[model samples]
Target: MVVLAGIQEGKDAIVEEGGIVALVEAIEDGSVKGKEFAVLTLLQLCVESVRNQGLLVSEGGIPPLVALSQTGSVRAKHKMITRN
Candidate 1:
């Protein structure tokens, strides 16, 4: 939830310091809520920083997000699409 709040407040530095790689990991292995929040946070972070967007794409964030869009819960899929 801290990540969620951080992103909502436009705290990209906080999120980046917390680690974009960690967020990618969460999207890969965390719970549904975790994945959703991670994706949302990444989306927000990416919006504010081209560097973060490049990091996400380079870290293999896309495939999992694509996979999640295919199989994740409706809400998760919705967040993925809307946020991306």
Candidate 2:
């Protein structure tokens, strides 16, 4: 709920947008399992954020995201890998 609210408020910004950070934090904190459906959704958003920010592949974020691509149902991996 709070994460959604943050996203709504910063609808323009990409990375600094509170919603993206909130969702990432939620996933890292392991609180989003009930919202497991959000994993793919958040990945899509993060890809967009990385693209818009022009983040390098060597950056810290790419590793975990790539690792994430190895798990989950095929559809989830599909979404994450397609962006790479």
The residue ranges of model 2 lying beyond 4 angstroms of the native Cα positions read: 1-10, 13-17, 26-60
Task: Write candidate 2's Cα lDDT for 14-74 as tens digits.
Answer: 4444445544444444433422444554544444455523432323444444555565456
Question: TM-score of every model?
Answer: 0.77, 0.41
Worst 10 residues of 1 by lDDT: 1-10
Which one is best on lDDT? 1
RMSD of each: 2.9, 5.5
Q: Counting only residues 3 or more apart in sequence or on different chains, how many pairs clash (N, Cα, C under 3 Å) in candidate 1?
A: 0
Model 2 residue 21 distance off true place after TM-score fit, in angstroms:
1.5
lDDT of 1: 0.75
Candidate 2: Cα lDDT at 10: 41
lDDT of 2 at 35: 28
- Cα error, candidate 1, residue 18 (Å): 5.3
lDDT of 1 at 60: 86
